[model samples]
Target chain A: MRFSIQQPALLHMLQVVSKAVAVRTPKQVLTGILLEADDNTLTTTAYDLELGIQDTIHSDDTNQLDVSTPGSIVLPARYLSEVIRKLPSDNVSISVNNNYMTSIQCGQVEFHLHGIDAEEFPKLPEFQSDTQIQLQSELLNDFIRSTTFAASNSEVRPILTGTHIQYTDGTLNFTATDGLRLATRSTTFDDADTHNWTAIIPSKSLSELSRLLPDNDTVIDVQLTDSHSLFVIGETYFYTRLIDGTYPDTSRIIPKVQRTEIRVNVKSIASAIDRAALIARDRDNHMVRLEVQGQKMTFSSSSPEIGNVSESVEASQKEGDDFQIAFNAKYVLDALAVFDNTDVLIRFNGSNQPFTIQQVDGDVGLQLISPVLMR
Target chain B: MRFSIQQPALLHMLQVVSKAVAVRTPKQVLTGILLEADDNTLTTTAYDLELGIQDTIHSDDTNQLDVSTPGSIVLPARYLSEVIRKLPSDNVSISVNNNYMTSIQCGQVEFHLHGIDAEEFPKLPEFQSDTQIQLQSELLNDFIRSTTFAASNSEVRPILTGTHIQYTDGTLNFTATDGLRLATRSTTFDDADTHNWTAIIPSKSLSELSRLLPDNDTVIDVQLTDSHSLFVIGETYFYTRLIDGTYPDTSRIIPKVQRTEIRVNVKSIASAIDRAALIARDRDNHMVRLEVQGQKMTFSSSSPEIGNVSESVEASQKEGDDFQIAFNAKYVLDALAVFDNTDVLIRFNGSNQPFTIQQVDGDVGLQLISPVLMR
Candidate 1:
């Protein structure tokens, strides 16, 4: 491959695809990024068998890129990144010899790298399904942020490490749980087709996709196959393998009846729980107790070796009977952090049952945490 | 002890002293910070046997602090810092009961901590020497930044891990080396005393002191004793134990005669060396070769597994014979980073002898690096 491109443009494309490069893998080709120059576009692709990212840059009126030949080569991602970043000039020229030795030149600096043949690199799986769903990048980003944190980090049950995503009618639902805690978010998106689909996407992949998604109203097209899913945003394509097992149904676990409910400012309760957590963190479960009486709620935690902490915040509204519950302080803090609303309504079914937290003003999302048994 | 102090003021004092708190130490009291409340000032101290830091807050015009009773206690540093940081109100009240159970109250929040008696905490050593040297904080900070990186990180020779400092007449010299490279910085300070003194201070302590020193010209008093050194900056006192060993003389390592001299732009050559280092870094020695001929200098490095890289930059002036030498790229980069000059003069004694780098216009500091013998 022989081509000359703007240093900044090439660097940006390399960084985007580098996210999928395999680190310390036995297969050396997986650690490389494939560069192909054809027609008026230069495409860069990186795949690690499980995840793949590809981006393309075009040579247009700006005259930032010039292609002298149509060819392809795979170069080590790490060294290529470093070389491109440290190149001295704005314009960089790259060429590959028949022996797969690549040369990169910019002004007075030149780097000759041993490149592997493009044939040795793995190709990204092609999506064969014609069915495609289009949604706003901002909505997808919010869904990932709201529910992914609740996914299981352990590999005991591999399916639990993924976020369950489903689309029925015009509603898109996202749910994740690690047995002790659950987070669910639902949103309405206009779609003409009535087809429904459900898939389990690894929380790790969802996080990377969220980082690449724009926060604005830009539309992104998503295609899902039986084993793989693909996301296309602008000129970039991201693909990830689907988890192989069925996700457990979590609807039954959410409490349907409430014995007590309280509405409190999110910041106030979050700060109180944070302070209590300082003591609770010394314990195994990071357990803290919450008691609701009249219009006040008190959060307390104690460690046999570190003393105790008690903090109270006034609730804006209270209903039903006064109650007490003990749960992990870290769970409540994580649930509270994803809320953009100032006030949240917390509902309790019983001292031992799971309690749910939801936005007081909107029905955007809900978080449920199971109480820990205390002697 | 009972006191009400502004949360911000107390937090600041805790942060300053907490730097000396021991982590994972066998002695329990070493992990706590000693808090002593007297007349109108609340003093906080933390000691890790080798280093100690103390700071005080007074109840004066701002009235941000109020002392109800005079007492002392030791509390865990990590937990106290977290609790104070998350407290809800500006004014926080702290008191201790006869049982050493301490209560921290702010607004509707309360934290009860098990405190240790102040007697268990190690006291900071008092400086017995009346002799003191006063210098500008900015100058001292610069001297530290110029020389400390050359200090040995390996404990094989414990004395090499400390920076040797000497004061004679009005000149203050700071020097550090790890056998392969040496850095020395000297400054002229106005001192009336004719007495000369030399001491070796641990590089870790110097690094911490550098972080605390202000960049502006503020006079700081430093006292050196037989076993300890005390630095008084405003209302804070920092103490560190002197390394109990004789420091090796490094004056003989700096070559006095030169076979080749070249003056080049620091930024241009630094950038070239940085790029060459990318290839050199794959090798054990991180060796990069530099060749100077006429007014141009070229930097190159090659690895059998990763190919090679070559970069050239123009030199403004060159004299003597043309030469080629190989050295660790990291050492040169670290030495070059400490220079504020736009251009540096490099002098070489021979291909095997050590070379020196200094500012082209001024002689504030000098760096000597030994070349690696290549087969």
Candidate 2:
């Protein structure tokens, strides 16, 4: 392929697709990025079996890209990234010979890179699906952030490593759990069709998708298939394989009754827990205890070797009987991070039952943490 | 000990002294910082056998510090740093009980930290030294930066891990080498005594000292003894033990006669070498070659598996004969980084002999690099 493009534009496109390049696989072609130039568009593709990313840049009125010949080549992603980053000029020209030997030139610098034929690269999976949904990029990002952290990091139960996403009526719900802790978020979209569906997507895929999404109100088109899902944002396409097992029913795990409830400032409690964590983190479970009495809430943690820490924060509102609970400090911190609101409402059934936390005035997000038995 | 100090001031003092705290030493007290409260000043000290650092904060007009009782105790550096960093108030109160159980209070949060008697901590080494020299902190920082990178990281030759500093006739010279490359910097101080002395300070100590030095032209008092060197910067005292070995003489290795000399823009050659290094770093030695013909200089590097790269930069002046030399690209990059001047003059004895690089107009810094024999 023979083409000349603005260095910045090419670099941006390469960065977007390179995330899918395999790091250390037996197949050499999996480590390369496929480049194809046809007509006025240049497309870059990278696939690592589990995930595939493709982006295209077109030659328009700005003349940022100029194609002299239509062809394809696969170049090693690591070296190509380093070369592009160190190129000295604004415009770069690249050409591939019959032997797949590529020459990249910019001003006084030139590099000859050995490339594999594009045919050797794996083809991205394509599926036929009639179900398509449109959602704002910012809302999808929020859903992913609120639930993904609660997903299981271990592979003991592969299904728990994926977030359960479902659509019913005009509302979308995302839920993730690791047995000990659970997080869920829901949002309503009036424009979505009434057709309902559910999918279990790996948390890693959702995280990567969140990073690629723009922070604006641009609409993203999502196509769901039985085995694969595709997300189209502008000229980029991100695809990931769906987890193959049924997700657990977490609805019964969330406590329905509360014996105690307290509303406190998010920053005050977060800081208090953070300080307590400094002592609690030395233990295996990272346990911190929270006690609610009247209008005051106290957080305390101690390690046999590191002494103890205690801090009290005044709750803005309290109701019902007072109670105490001990749970992982990291779980509460993660749950608190997803809320932009200043105040959070926490409800407890008992010291041993799972407690739920949510925004003081909205039902958009909810998180539940199971208490750990304290000695 | 009972004291109330501004959180920022205590944090700053802890950070400065914490650099000397032992990471994984057998002596438990080495991991703790010794805190001493006198009438009006609170002192913090940390020592790890090889290095000791002490800093004092006084209760001045701003009343940043208040000492109510005079006592001393040693507290673990890691936990104390974390607690002070997370304190919620500007002013923090610390008190040590008769049993050395310390209570730290700030705002509504309180921590009870276990502390050891100050007598258990290793005492700072005492030395008799009347030879004192005063130099600007900025100049000492410059000397450290220009020479420290060339120090050997390997322990094969322990002497090479230290920088040889010599003072004679009002001039201070700093030099370091790792067998393959050598860097030297010299500066003059008019106020220094004519009495001559030399010391080999570990590169690690110089690096830490450089970080603590202020950027302004504040005078620093340096006292050199037989076995230790103490630098007093304002209220901080930094003590480091000298390396117990004889340093090799590097004067004979720098080539005196040259057959080829070239003057080139530092940025142009440095950027070319940096780009070439992208290809060269995959090899064992990180080799990059430079060929000077007339006024054009070319840099090239190749790996058997990763292809090759070539770039040309124009030299402003050339003398004697055209030549080609190969050396470690990282060595040249590190040497070039010490020079802020745009132009540098490089003198070459031959293709195989060591070449020297220096500022085009000044004699303050000089670097010598040995070329590798190519296949």
Candidate 3:
């Protein structure tokens, strides 16, 4: 195989696909990326059994392409990326001999790496699905950002480690929960179909795609099968295996009624909670109490050994009876971070009950965290 | 202690001095910073036996002074710093009650911390030296940056972990070595004092000070005692205990004569070495070979299992015979990072002998590294 490519273009493509490379795999070839150069297009693919990524670069349209032979090989992702990034020249020339010894040259620098036969690398699963959905990249990115963090970090309850995604009646919903907290986001689709599809995607896969999502308003096409899902963005393809269990029904857990509600500036309340957390962090449960009276919300925490701290921020608006509640400070902070707006509406059912926080002006996304019983 | 000070000012002072706080000391009071408020100033001090820092904030000169009572108390450094940084107001009011309970208030925020009795805190050692010298902070910081990296990270040889500093014959010399490599820097002081002094300051202490040193050309006063040294910059005082062991003689290891010399652009060679390091890093020794032939210098490294890589760059000038030598790429990279100039002079004595690297423009700082035997 012989190919000449622009260094930056190749480096960017390699970086986008290398995210799927397995860090520790029993099979050494699983940690490599399959590079195939044919005609005017070069494709890079990486699969780690559970997740896979494929990105293609067109040399003919983008720049110059001189390919004497068309072939494929698998190279270690990390070493290849490093060499490509550190090369001294703008253009890099790569060629492979019959012995699978690849030579990469750029200006005054050259690197020779032993490549595994591409046939030995596992191929990405083909997308064989009739259900197809198209959405804006921005919308997809927001869905991942809002729901993924609440997913369980442990694998004891395998289903809880994934984000439940469902499309029904022209509406798309994504929910993630770890029993302690749940994040749910929904948006209505323009095109309605008779088909109802649901899938539980591991949070790790969504996070990798989120990192590579473009900021521009590009359209992303998603295809789903019974056991696998695929996301196609521009010249890139991302595929991941679905979790094998059913997600728990979380609708009954959300409070049907709220006795008290408070609207406060997100930054003000977040900072108050942060300071109170400094004291609570030394305690066993990292708990902080919040009390609302009139328009002032007081945040406080106390540790027998570290002392106590209290801070109050004025609520923009208040309703119903004044209330007091206790919660893990970190959970509240994580919920607050998703909001890009100035104000957030916080609804409380009662002390020791779960509370819901949502954007002040919108109800598309909401976070619910169960309160800790005060000792 | 009672004082109303600017929050940012107090926070900055605490951060600078808090580095000396012992995180897990046997004596609990050693984990706190002693705060003393007087008629016109608020002083903060932290001593960890080996290192001490004291900083004073003048209220009369910068802001209004309203101290109803003058007292001293010790507050936990990490908690205090975090609270101060997160406070919402610009001015922070601190007051100690009769029971040594400290109240810190800023705007709508208040923190109550249980403080230790200031009497239990250890006092910083006094500097009783009559011979004092003043030097530019820039010069002091440069001396530290050039020599500290060569200091041994292990405590097996205690003296090698400290940077040896000596003032002799109007020249101030700083040297550090870990047996494998040595770095030395010196500058002539204009004031010829008859009193000569030598001390080994712990690299950790110097590194901490280097992080806080100002970039401007400010004069810093230095005072030396039998076992301690004090540095005063404005209202801040930094004290560190001197290492007790004698430094080894490293002058003899630096080659006085060279058989081969090469001058190259620092960036060009450093980048080449960085690329070569990608392959060598997987090897046991992380060794890279440099071969100088005519005006071109080739950098190469190989791993039996991972393959090999080589890159060559043109040298600006060359003298004597061409030679090839192998050394740890990391050590060479560390030595090259200290040069601020575009060009560097690399001198080689023989295949296995130590070589020197110095800035092409100046002779102040020099680095010597011994070659690794080829397999």
Candidate 4:
């Protein structure tokens, strides 16, 4: 198999597919990206069992390939990427001579790499269900930003490490939780399929895929199976395995009725958290206390060795008795930052109860942060 | 003591003085900066025993401070600096109540901190030296860049970590070596103190001083002692201890004879080395080899477990005959980057001998890289 393509075009496809190529995996082939050069197109695919990425690039010239030989070879992603990026020219020639040697040539620079037959790569799964769902790229990405940050990054519990995406009738909901905090985004999908579906995809894979989705009015095609889910946009396809466990019901953690509802400018609240973080960063627990009363709020944090800080701000809220609550400054800052709106309504059930924060007029998403016991 | 200063000015001075505070120094007190507020100047000083930096900011308004309440104290550099950076206003009011507490107030935000007695800070040595040498700030900085990179950072031999500077009459010379590579830079001072002087200053301290030098054409004052050197420029004073042990005689390592002399574009060679670095980064020993044969030169690197690459380039120097030498790519690239000139002349003595490279124009600086044996 032989092919000649623009260096940039091939390099772009390599970077896309190489995301699935793990540096050190149990399976050696998972660490390499499989390249299949055909008559007019070059397909690069890579998988690490949990998540896989496949992309294809079409050349401008039909003469780019001398033969229509459909053969595949697996090459180390990192090294192959380096070779292409350092090339001195726009177009690079790539050829495979049987199973042992794959040569890449550009100007006076040439690289001959030893490669394994593509058959060694894991078999690709077919999306058997035709019940594909579609959503606007921008809205879908917004849903990801609202939920992905709350996902448990530490893989102590594999199921919690995945974000649960559920769709039914005309509604689409995405949720992520790290036990301490839960973030959910829900919206009406005008083009949603009638079929009921739910899948727990690794939050990291969705975060990475969200970056690759098209912008603006472009639509993304999503397909779900019993074992895995797929997201397709243009020439790139991302597949992630579904975690084989039931996601915990998070509805109970969010309060249906808040004892006090305070509306504060998001930027003002975010800045307060940032200032508190300077001291919080030195503490062992890294917690900051937020005490809300009638029409005033106090932000305070203390480190035994470094003294203490307490600042107050005039805030608008439902007239009620005062209550105190403490939460991880890191989480509060992150949740507050997700809103682009001018003001956010922070609702609380009590001092020890989980708190819900949402944009003043936005019921599209909700964030719940559990309070830490500040002695 | 009470004073008010702009936030940005305080932050700027904090960044420079904080550089002398090491994160993991054995003496915990050395991690704090000594702040002395007196009259019209606010002086912030930091010392790590081996090196010291003190910088002062003058406030035009007498309201910032009163000479009647002259005071001195030490506080953690990182926290104070971060607090000032996160303050909500342009100007901050700092007042020391008694000698036990320090308060910084800005807008509605206030930060209180415990301060260490200024008496605990190490005293600055009274530099008593008869020989005084001065040079352009840019020129002194240039000498540092030319030779400091070759200093050994290894703790096995503490003396090798210093760069030796010698001044006699109107000529000043600097040199550093790490057993393998030796670099030297020299320049003439217009009015030197007519006596020979030699001292070895830790390269790390000199590096910090080099970066902090002002970007102006004015000459910097140099005060030298048998054990320490002081660089005073305007309101900033930098002091560094001199290495007591004798520095090695690196002048003997430079080869006087050569079998090959190559004149090549410095940028092209540096780029080639950077590209070769991709493969060498994964290898056990980060080394790349260059083979010169007549008009062509071959650059190659290989890892047994990975792959190998060999590329040839037509050289302007064909008189080198044939020879192969290997060297650490990182070191070579760093030294080459210091040369801003286009054409560089490389001096070679067989394949095993240490070679020296210098700019075609007499640039006063010379870089040497030793060849590593490939086993």
Runs off by more than 4 Å, candidate 3: A60-65, B60-65
Docking quality of model 1: it rates as high
Docking class of 4: medium
lDDT of 2 by residue, B139-195 (tens): 889889999889999999999999999988888899999999999998877764457
Ranking by TM-score: 2, 1, 3, 4
- Local distance difference test scores for all models: 0.90, 0.90, 0.88, 0.81
Which of 3 and 4 is the better model by TM-score? 3
Chain B TM-score per candidate, please.
0.97, 0.97, 0.96, 0.94
lDDT of 1 at B83: 90
Each model's iRMS: 1.3, 0.7, 1.1, 1.6
For candidate 2, write residues A1-375 as lDDT tens digits.
899998888888889998899998999999999999988899999999999999998897553798999999999999998899888648899999768989989999988888999999998888578777888998888889999999999999999999999988888899999889999998887754547888999999999999899988999998999988999999999999999978888889877779988888888898999999999874558899988889889999987777888999999999999888898999999999888758898998879899999998766589999898767
Per-residue CA lDDT of model 3 for A1-375, tens digit only, reads: 999887878888889998899999889998898999998889999999999999987766454656668989999888898889888547788999767889998887889999999999997888777798988999999899999999999988999999999988888999999999999999887676436789999999999999988976799989998889999999999999999877899999998789888888888888888899999964556799998888889999998888899988889899988888899999999999998757888899878789999998866599999998987
Clashing pairs in 2: none
Off by over 4 Å in 2: A61-63, A192-194, B61-63, B192-194
- Predicted candidate 4 versus true structure: per-residue lDDT over A1-375, tens digit per residue: 677777777788888887788878777778888999776678999898878999987756632433356677898887889888887756677878755578777766667777778888997778978767887888888888889889998879988899999887778899999999999988875653358788898999988888787667687889988898888887888998888899999877788987788888888778877887777754555788888877788888877677667777777665555799888989988888789857888888778899888888766599999999767
TM-score of each: 0.98, 0.98, 0.97, 0.95
Residue B99 of model 3 has an lDDT of 75
